[model samples]
Target: MAPNDTQVSFALAEPPVETAPAPAEQLRTRFGTLTIKPAHKLEMPRGPFGFSDYTQFALADVPNQPASQFRILQSLEDTEVSFIVLPTAADNEWIGTADFEAACASYCFDPTTSGLLLIATMRRDTNGQVKATVNLKAPIVLDTANQLARQVVFTSDAYTIRHPLEL
Candidate 1:
């Protein structure tokens, strides 16, 4: 009876790194087959500002956009109905002096938690040039956790409908 002398030492295997979750589901629409990550889908509690017919929308990043500050919110029901939206915080200067924290507080949303403030995009003719504007009167506050959006309007008239771009 001889004892084995060649026992090799073994190390515990390391866990694999976490990877992005699989696509929640696929949506076939005007944007083509979009493998929707759950986060991209959104619902409007009362629908966008004046748009009441549609309740469901998906946020999409524009392909090859220069500024990359705009997102296309495509209506689930209508292909032709879509909105170009901008996050107010995208540009620090564009974010007016209005009380955004108060607005969020009124809606029971805390931007520090799971919330994003956005505005509807508007096109304006500026001295023979077409420029983009954002409606600051009513801002769409998105709840990242519930995916619910509410277009909250401030009581005071500090924000206007046409906050045109400085450029």
Candidate 2:
């Protein structure tokens, strides 16, 4: 499925529930203290690469950037374990529909129900200019229906681990 077909909508203002509400947990992250509800938490059977021990994570929107495509994938196990991610649809130049579908299929992810998020990194170049790059080779496939996520690596040469963003 194409990225557009898998777009997930996040309702910022949750509607009132009739039943007892789930207790919200607060965690201190690099972004500051974030209140995470049970619905916003994700379980990773196999955590992200290099961080296998940490399986629980909370998906939070970037504070003060409601319209931005960026999101915070904060690990519940550690305060310092957080990453900025962008939806695959945000940048379709490198990862085509075919490549994305293939990668998701290998991981048994339903392209129709699963969404992709690319890990983003920033650094200063020799010119003293900040450059941002996204890891397209390995993206986190989120099964929104089940709130389960896992990192899948693509073997396609068309994508790179660090694809420079033209920001």
lDDT per residue (tens digit) for residues 92-155 in model 1: 3433433566656676765554333445454546567657667767777765556667777766
How do the residues 76-102 of candidate 2 rate in per-residue lDDT, one tens digit apiece? 989899898876542355667777777
Model 1 per-residue lDDT at 52: 88
Weakest ten-residue segment in model 2 by summed lDDT? 6-15
**Local error of candidate 1 at 136, Å?**
0.7
TM-score each candidate. 0.67, 0.79
lDDT of all the models against the reference? 0.58, 0.75
The whole-model C-alpha lDDT of candidate 1 against the native structure comes to 0.58
Error of 1 at 122 (Å): 5.0
